[model samples]
Target: MSTVIEIDRLSKSYVVPVRGAGVRASIVSLVKRKTRTVEAVKEISLSVEAGEVVGFLGPNGAGKTTTLKMLSGLLHPTGGTASVLGFEPWKRNNDFLRQITLVMGQRNQLIWDIPVIDSFDRNRVIYRLTREEYRERLDELVELLELGELLSKPVRNLSLGERMKCEVAAALLHHPRILFLDEPTLGLDVSMQRRLRTFVEQYNKRTGATVLLTSHYMADVEALCPRVVVIHHGELLFDGKLADLVRKFSAQKTLVLELEESQEDLSRFGQVVSQEGSRATLRVPKQDTAEVTARILRELKVQDLNVADPPIDEIIDQVFSRGMA
Candidate 1:
């Protein structure tokens, strides 16, 4: 695959005015101001290939949004360089903008009183799509997102989930080759989140658009991205396969056991995470997983048992904690 997104020491920063409380202090600060420089994105370099779905993972204020904004040509970087589709992102060229799209979960680009399809039409015009192309793409998005019923409804009348579906469709109306999704599933119910994830997967497969997604929901990352890039404090921490991240940082394994009898204490084998009628979940050291599994089978009445890696979120937490340390 060809490299579509190439970032070399990309960085961003901000300067903000500082002020203190009290009328006297505020008046005195009118003439002489205090200011500080905040680094939103430290020097970070990464390369993404065409048609790849890579997860961008970081906590709040970790510069995930800042990086995406810079890459989408919405913000100017303080230092370094980035090239998306062989165009400098901060330059905001029309050719570059036409080939990429950014969907922010917390923000909306649709007009409030207009119907969802009207908003999509607005984007269709902005991207200069022909009537037939617009209709074909709209139909495909409507079927994939199940937006046939919601399109004619006013944007104000739609619920958060419904509006989010429309927002994604509007962003993709032009069939951009690159997608920057920042928390696209935020504030949605479990079913809605799953639906959006499925739609994104289908869109990528159908269009072959490269995706750089930043989501707090681990399920989104696990489902869509084979590779993940972790950033903390505006610095790169890890960039590798999802399974490699788990293997490198995670120290524990999870064992799920189905007991023939209920209410049995299994603390001697490992740390009991949870237990219910005839079933228990344990967290055991990775090194001791095999031995504990055998011992549990030897001692307890086990109808069924399974061993698996710890949850992805837990492994990610470990990654951030260790990186901060």
Candidate 2:
């Protein structure tokens, strides 16, 4: 695959005025204003190949949305550079804008009072798609996203999940080759989240579009992205396969053991996470997993045993806690 998105030392910063609380100090600050520079995104470099779905991982205010905005041409960077499909993103070229779509979870692009289909048609017009091309793509999206029933309803009448589905469909009507999804599944219930994930997977497989997604929900990342790039404190910390991230940052391993009896105290071996009937889940240090497993089996009769990495959420928390180490 070819490199569809490339950035070298890409950075974005903001300078905000600072003021004192008291009236005298505030009045003095009018003449001599104090300001601080906040680096939303530091010198971070990354390359994304065509047809790849990459999870852009970071916590709240950790520059995930800022980076996405820069890549989608919504914001100009303070320093460094980025190229998307051979066009500088900050330049906002017509060709570049038509070839990419950004879907933000907390924001809405559709007209609130209009029917969902109207908003989709507006996007079709903006992208200047031929009638036949628009119809074809719209039909595909309606079918895949199951947007048929919700299309005629006004945006105000639809539920949050329904509106989100339409928002995604609207964004894709132009057949953008690059998708920048920032928390696409935010505020969605479990089933709705799953449906959206499935649609994203199918869309990528069918169109071979490149996707960069940022979500707090790990399930979204696990379901759609094979590779992940982690950023924290406006810095790039790790970039590779999701499995490798688990192996690198996870200091503890989980052991699920089905014991012959439920009464045994397993705290001697490891931290017992939960116990129900004969099933117990334990968390042990990664380095002593083997020793803990042996001790558990030798001391207590075990019927079944399985060892796995700590949950992705835990690993991510660990990564944020120990930033840049």
Candidate 3:
């Protein structure tokens, strides 16, 4: 696979004004001009291959958006280098801009008062697409996104989910080779989010567009991306497959048992995570799970037993709580 996105020591920093609580101190500081340096994105290196859908995972204020902005030529980096599709991103080459699209879930690029088709037409003019190309691409997007009646309605009248679908359709009118999505499914309902994910996966399949997506929703990451780059405090933490992340961060498996009798304790078998009546959940070391299950069945009342890995959210939470230790 060819490398579509590359970064070496890419970083962005900001100097924020510092103000004291007291009025006198605030006045004094205004004259003195005190500021502190903040590293929104540390020196992070990344490489993305063509036709790959990768997840950019991080908590809020973790520099996910900052990095995306630099990659899309919307923000100039304070230091280091980045190349997208063989062009420097900060230079904002017209050809480079035409081949990339950035979509923020909470932000809208569509005209609120205009019908969705009009906004798409605006994109058509901006990208310098001919009428025939625009019509073909628009037809394809409308079909893929199921934007039949929705295109005739004004953007302000559409629901959040509908508006998002339109936003995606508008962004894809130019058939960008690279797509940057920041929180694309942030506030939608579960069903809407799933639909958007499915659409994106299909688009990538048909067009082979390279995508770098950032989202707080784990479901979006799991559904659409096979590889994930985890970041925290503006630094890269892990860059690998999602399954590798689970294995690296998750130390235990889950064991659930339904006892024949109510109110019985099974603490001796493993770490009891939750106990309610005859049903109890246990956390056992991965290597010791089989042993613990055998002991539980042999020593305790035989009943229904279930074994599985712990939830992905819990494992991720543990990693964040530990702070990259």
TM-score of each: 0.95, 0.97, 0.95
Regions of model 1 farther than 4 Å from truth:
322-325
lDDT of 2 by residue, 219-280 (tens): 99999999999989888899999999999888899999998889888899889999999999
Better of 2 and 3 by TM-score: 2
Task: Please state the error at residue 311 of candidate 3 in Å.
Answer: 1.2
Query: Could you say which candidate leads in TM-score?
Result: 2
Instruction: Using lDDT as the measure, name the better of candidate 2 and candidate 3.
Output: 2
lDDT of each: 0.94, 0.94, 0.93
Per-residue lDDT tens digits of candidate 1, residues 208-273? 999999999999999999999988999988899999988888899999999999988899999999
* Of candidates 2 and 1, the better by TM-score: 2
Query: What are the clashing pairs of model 1?
Result: none
- Locate the minimum summed-lDDT window of 10 residues in model 1: 316-325
- Root-mean-square deviation (CA) per prediction: 1.5, 1.1, 1.6
Q: In candidate 2, which residue ranges exceed 4 Å CA deviation?
A: none
Worst 10 residues of 3 by lDDT: 261-270
State how far residue 192 of model 1 sits from its true place (Å): 1.1
